[model samples]
Target: MSRPLTATINLAALRANYLLAKRLHGGKVLAIVKANAYGHGAARCAQALAEVADGFGVAAIEEAIQLREAGIRQPILLLEGWFEASELPLIERYDLWTAMHSLSQVADIEAATLSRPLTVWAKIDSGMHRLGIAPSDFPELHARLEATGKVGKIVAMTHFARADELDCDTTPRQSACFMAAIAGLKVETSLCNSGGILAWPDLHGDWGRAGVMLYGGTAADRQLPDWPQAVMNLDSRIMAVRELSAGEPIGYGGGFVTERPTRVGVVACGYADGYPRVVPSDTPVLIDGQRGRIIGRVSMDMLTVDLTEHPHAGVGTAVRLWGEGLPAAEIAASAGTIDYELFCNVKRARFEYQG
Candidate 1:
């Protein structure tokens, strides 16, 4: 069988990042493994961090159940909480925590009758306006949930809108609002995500949700004393190599015009495989452990790279799209995007988990 174009994940590195996040926050770490641990394979990553993470954070109730089925004993916080009222039973069965952001969720909890009271977190909408309850309604929301005998514990939390921008004052302002809204509640709090955990220490609370930072990506450009290793090395093989003459166009729509006699390497990966489709020619791709630039437009199943400077180019050679020696942020830049996009877009067909 042929080795498919795939990404190799470093499980050790993931654990290190989780440990670092915990150390930085000086509190419990909720390893945010949502979106398949940002495409690094949630089950694998969570299993590796089970001993270290105080808990896990996932977007859906099913993901929480998956961890439980996989033997993960740590508390799992549902980031989106229960989408439907019916999910409450499963959440309670798994002892997973839910983030009650809206009035409907409060009603669901009130209607629930589990053997054990449900652990709930109040998500305050300081500014993101994505989810969470309004600051003005925090008091009333808290009262309603507490009134329900099903409430086990309540945590006050909020999401940061500008956590990735170091200079953005919104993080601090949001923190103030969250604190004000939850005043006198006397419960544990959690407000920090990846960016907040790494850059804004003040945002750290009783618990922090560490995401991208635990995957070896820097948030807010803040440098850690010992950065975590890249967990995913996305690579493909060189299918063919060709020599081109000056003035000759390369790839579709003539996006690349050769400046001189040049060599092009065709790689076996494309947008269909989760490589960005918008990536223009001249995007950098590592060939044979050497830096090479894309020569033409990206296609659905393949893309070409300029290999004039690579002396050892040939068939079946390897190309590092990201991770390993190549940084994801750099690859994202070449494709006119961000590291988050590249990580999240990794298709299911390509994968090899190290953990």
Candidate 2:
């Protein structure tokens, strides 16, 4: 028998999440399929959302090409844009949208000969100070891209720095800075990502980038118009059952000592399977539909769970790492991380997609 470890991806939940973004943000949503749709299988997720999403956003030309090859006909935006001048023609050939984040990109566009004018997003580094033109200089940069005549439909966009903090004023200040930068321009703006869409209802734009939220991550505060369903369910199974007396220790470094007589189920998954090893004992898991907590240090290929609460669970009992009955966010929070990292780190697990 094969290892029960698998990631079940529900495409319907994914589509519904995309629609939720549209309903909440009230605009065109570029469903972020970058990072392989945050490790939920990019082609499948993109195909599921192709009919509803206004467009799709990816990290680079390579990802854009991957989507195009997978039959994604909707407009795909190269969120990070071209890495070299050589990618310009390929960007044109793929009929993909590219972001103008730096002056070198602006220069590249000016020097390159393309088959036609390109739809470019003028990225403003409002406050993130990441990969965008400075807000103070964005208006002029917008004008410069326009003057190049090779550019068309420049969408002004900025990423929020602290939008996940519901009470933080950074997002608002960043929005103000971005608006001030493009105050006189008649360009359609994209200002909201998942965090902005969830926490700042009053703030939206003509185009909103829906990222991790669409994958049913974030929302740590439960701030949403509707409860978005998690699309991926990571599951594994018990390999052995241990009957240990009090004072018995589990896994490496004797991280967790058994309190009272205990039942431990050795699961066929561990850190190498993308489960965070630092998530101290008591990280949650679902065993045979019963809630249980991980016990002790996670190993490279296995982890142990306290099955004392679950008398009926034994070898081959279904164990859910997260999704559906168990939420990944809950586990992530326990690990001092975010669900995006958890979702993207999943590897070596057989993926099964369902509608």
Candidate 3:
């Protein structure tokens, strides 16, 4: 038997999440499986969701090619589109749908001479201002792509700048801006990310891209069209348990001191294993399905959790850092970080799949 220092991935939960996202979009769902499915293993996650998802979205062309080679016949939308001119041929070969955001990418697409017409998506710079062509340039780019004869279906896409901010006005502004730019062309539209799909229902368009929400993480307050199930549980075992007297310091720099007689448990996971070191003292860790708080600085290979409240906790007890009743967002909030970073930072540890 292996130690409990492993991540358990639930494929059934992932499929349920896919269906939830699809129901919310009220159209075809383009599952965002980039960043190795947000650190849940891209290939496996994609394969698990293949029957439920209409398509897949990845940040790189290489990832799409990998899926294609694996016999995943679904359409793959390249979120970053072409990084360089040399990637054009590979994009065509894989039948990838490129999200065209810059003039150089447009030029690369026009210059490439492939056997069949390549599908191109015109990404508008709505409000993120990170990539995508300006609205003023959209019409000209659309004209050039139309003239290229090598271009196939052209969908207009934009990302919301503040869809997660429930009270922010940016989502609507970006949505209006995107709609105004594509009003004339009337091609397929994809403006909603996970946040928009859940919080701003009006922003959902012809296609919807769901990422974090499909993993049971909330981006906004709105209820999911279908309930998204938690897909991963990060757990470990208590390697050591000890009792401490009043005022005894715990871990490095004495970040935590026992206020009274206390019992503590040490888990075999730390920053090296992707558990954040910056998590404040007293951040919650789970033991025997009860909550225990970290009582000291998170060390490189272990973290100390005060089990004074749960005296029955002992060595070899399973400790869940997140998942189940403890959501990743709650842990992230205590760590002064966000859910996305925590999800993507899962280190090189063994994983057990339950779904």
Candidate 4:
């Protein structure tokens, strides 16, 4: 048959995670489905969450349009807003919500005439300087958008730069700035990302955007009482197994050399399949339900694992790259990256969705 590699998307777990976010925050949740639902397949994941989510968040207008085409009826927020004025029409046609982060975006929104007034999220750059107007400029911008009468409800929002760090003071400082900026405004507010939703309960407002955690990725310093279920199980199979003598080098560049008699299993997964090639030799992998350590530099199509501890594992032995019993966060940490990158980088595996 075809390659014994598959990326299984767990729809039931995805729904449960969304509901968990709702229960934890006790507010409307803008399910962050940007970057293809953090690479879990946006259309499928969004459809699964459509019934319960307050709304969905995407990185741009194109993603929102794609969801609309897929029959997703939930309100989709453009987290990064429109890139150009031309996208404003599509945003209006799709009935999408836009974030006004820059003065130029505000100008573009004001100049466009739409069939209905558009909902806007006035973004303030409390700490993250990547996108958003300064706190000092938020008042005038909000007033300007309101005066145009072309906008519907305007929600004040900001992104926390250090919500994941429990010891960091940046979140509190940014929250204070945002609070001061929108102190007397009549608009509702949102500031919590997944980390904020879990760690800083006070930051949850009219809306909380849940991203990585909804897919079973960790966001805080400590584990919570309610951990999200893993929504994607990346698996493969052992294609071959061999016995190696002491001092034998394995894989490319001799990155790993056997010190004693060892058994190795070649897994049908590698960097090309979105597995991190740079993962350290000690990174763990599961083969036939037994833990094994990667032994050498990962190749494009395959990688070798130390299977000496499990002599029963041979060709066709089940292998789990991440998810389910093995956490992606743990793998990512060993790879010098984050779970978000690992999820978004998956592109070469066959998909199997389960409810």
Candidate 5:
């Protein structure tokens, strides 16, 4: 028999999430498929969302080109924009939209010779201090790009630094700065990410960039909309079962010691498969539809679960890592991380896609 480990990608769920973002924002959504659709397979996910999405956002030019080659007809935006002047021609050939984050990127566009004017998003660094021109520099940079005459329509945009934290005032402050920066400009604006779309209704504008939420992860402290569903169901099967008495140590470094007589079911999943090694023993997994706790340190290829209460479960019993009844958010919280890392780190598992 083949390995029982599999990461199932549900395209239907992905589409539903996209629609949820669209509905919530009441505007166009740029379905973010960067980092290989947060490791759900970009080509397939993009194809799944191509019909309804206003456009797609990717981290670099390569990602956009891949979608273009895949025959995705929707507009593809380079979220990070062109890295060098040489990429400008290819960006034009692919009919791609780009973000002008740095003055150097603007210069590249100005120097390039294109068959037609290109759509550009002037990214303002409201407070993230990571990318984009400073809020104070927006007017000067916008004027510079306009003088080039190569830009057809310029959209003002910024990324939120703390939209996920409802208690934080950073997002609101950033919005204020963004508004002030573009006060006199008539350009359309894009401000919301997944968190912004869900938490900051006032931040939604011409476009919403939906990322992790579209794959069934919560973006903020609030509850997820009912329409969004888990796009990835990561699961494996029990490979072995053993009985251990009290005081028996489990896994490397004797991380966990059996408190009583125990039935241990070894599952064919571990850190190498993207299950976080640091996840404590109390973390839960579903075995034979019964909740079980991981007993010790996760190994490279396997992890042991306490199955003392589920004697009926044995080899070949189904185990859910996270999905459906088990929310990834719960697992993420236990793992001292977030759902984004969990989704992106999945590796070596066979993938099955259902539309």
Candidate 6:
């Protein structure tokens, strides 16, 4: 038999989380399926939500093309726009919405020959200092895209830098800047990511990008008290159980030592399965539906969990690395990462999808 490791994608929970975003945001919501729906398998997740989602968001033209190939008929927006001039033709052929974040991208749009006008999302770098046109330059960008006569229905959008931080003023400041920049432009706008939707209802726009939250992730810790249901779980099993004395050292580098008699279960999951190797001792997991924790270095193929709390846990006992009962955010916090990274990095695990 294969290794007892699996990443179960919960499609019902996926739809629930998405509908929650749609209901809560009270506007058009684009399910961000970039990075293979954050590694939940884009095609399946997109199909599950195909009936309700306003559209989908991806990082580039390739991802959009993949969705189109998968028969995702809804609007697909390329969040990063085209990588080079050559991709413009593919963008047109796929009927994809492209984000115009740079003057060079504008030049490419102007010079391209197209079968029809394209939907454009005009990106404003109100904050985040990432891939977006400057607020000062947005007016010129809009004019140029319109002048080309190859663009139609420009949607103003911006990514929030600090929407996850409830106490931060950055979101409000950025929102004000974006609104001021787009004033009198008479274009629909998209400003909220998952964090923005959760925290600032007053700032909701014509369109919102539901990203991390769509796959059971979050606005992170601030909204942990009531984040939506997790859509995927990393499950594994104990391969072996070890009884050790108080002074025994565990795993690589002897970094963790037992202070008491310990019951350790070697889980069939490790860094190779996308569990973080740098996770310090006491990282959380679930054994036979009971709480457990990791206690040593994670090898490529296996890691040891403290099963002393559960006297009945042994080889073949079920284990959950994260999801459902055990949140991915908790494991990510222990590893000094985020749930997005944990989901995107999963590998070497059989997938089981359930509603």
TM-score of each: 0.96, 0.97, 0.97, 0.98, 0.98, 0.97
Give the top-scoring candidate (lDDT).
Answer: 5
**How much lDDT does each candidate structure score?**
0.85, 0.89, 0.86, 0.90, 0.91, 0.90
- Candidate 6 whole-model C-alpha lDDT, 0 to 1: 0.90
RMSD to truth, every model: 1.4, 1.2, 1.3, 1.0, 1.1, 1.4
User: Which stretches of model 6 miss by more than 4 angstroms?
Assistant: 220-226
Could you tell me the lDDT of residue 252 within candidate 2? Answer: 95
**lDDT at residue 2 of model 4 (Cα atoms):** 92
10 residues in a row with least lDDT, candidate 3: 221-230
Question: Judged by TM-score relative to the true structure, which candidate is superior, 1 or 3?
Answer: 3
Candidates sorted by lDDT, best first: 5, 4, 6, 2, 3, 1
Q: Lowest-lDDT window of 10 residues in candidate 2?
A: 219-228
User: Which tens-of-lDDT digit does each residue in 1-355 have in candidate 3?
Assistant: 7656888999999998888888877988899989988988888888888887899999998889878877789999999888788988888777888887887677776777788988887899998999889988888888888888988799999998788899989999999999888877848999999998888877799999999987887777676445656788999989998889999999999978899998989888889888889999878878889977888899888999888888778988889988876888888998888878888998856887766
Error of 3 at 69 (Å): 2.8
Cα shift from native, residue 101, model 1 (Å): 0.8
What's the lDDT for candidate 1? 0.85
**Residue-by-residue lDDT tens digits, candidate 6, 178-229:** 9999888879999999998888899999998999999888673445444579
Compared with the true structure, what per-residue lDDT tens digits does model 2 show for residues 220-323?
35555566688999999999999999999888999689988999999999889998988988888988887888998999999999988899899899899999
- Poorly placed runs, candidate 1 (over 4 Å): none
| lDDT score at residue 28, model 4, on the 0-100 scale | 94
Please give, for residues 1-355, the per-residue lDDT of candidate 4 as tens digits.
9998899999999998888888889889999999999999999999999889999999998898889999999899999887888888888888999887987677787788788898899899998998888898888888888898899899999999989999999999999999999877789899999999999998788899999999999888757656868999999999999899999999999979999999999999989989999997979998887778899899999999998998888999999999988999999999889999999999889988999
Cα deviation at 319, candidate 1, in Å, is: 1.0
| Residue 141 of model 2, lDDT score | 80
